[model samples]
Target: MFAARFHPPMASAPPLCRRGVPSDRPAAKDPDAPNPL
Candidate 1:
């Protein structure tokens, strides 16, 4: 399952990195979540 662990963070990192805001925390938690961006 080690690869699975990396996958989640890798997938989440893109949106958070692009947004570069604390709001990304929630957005990353919920992919369907809407963002002002």
Candidate 2:
């Protein structure tokens, strides 16, 4: 349930998320990360 919201952003940047970008870590949890897309 909690992951639904985060899914969108993560889906948008799966590469970054998969790469485990430390900076993008927060972005995976929230949409506050600098959207490179």
Candidate 3:
């Protein structure tokens, strides 16, 4: 059954990445702005 397959304790979960950086909002007409490619 599905319940038996996932019944193990979840204490071994991997750590999550939380290093988010704040970005500046570029103007709509900025010719030198980097493309979001």
Candidate 4:
């Protein structure tokens, strides 16, 4: 049961990381412009 609980969540993690939509922070298009975060 303990292994079952941990394994499923870890398996799903890779897809989330690949999506690259981390947090609400915005990506910068230009270095001179202010950070959108």
Q: What is the TM-score of each candidate against the true structure?
A: 0.48, 0.28, 0.21, 0.47
- The segments of candidate 4 whose C-alpha lies over 4 angstroms from its true place after superposition are 21-37
Q: Model 2, 1-37: lDDT tens per residue? A: 8799888877879776666786667667566454543
What's the lDDT for all of these models? 0.78, 0.71, 0.36, 0.65
Ten contiguous residues with the weakest lDDT in model 1 = 28-37
Give the TM-score (vs. native) of candidate 1: 0.48
Q: Is candidate 1 or candidate 2 better by lDDT?
A: 1
lDDT minimum window of 10 residues, candidate 2: 28-37
Local accuracy of candidate 1 as per-residue lDDT tens digits, 1-37: 9999999999999997778775777668677555433
Positional deviation of 33 in candidate 3, in angstroms?
37
Pitting candidate 1 against candidate 3, the one with the higher lDDT is 1
Model 4 lDDT tens row, 1-37: 9999999999899977766664323443443256453
Off by over 4 Å in 2: 15-37
* Candidate number with the higher lDDT (2 or 3): 2
User: Clashing pairs in model 1?
Assistant: none
Model 4, poorest ten-residue lDDT window?
23-32
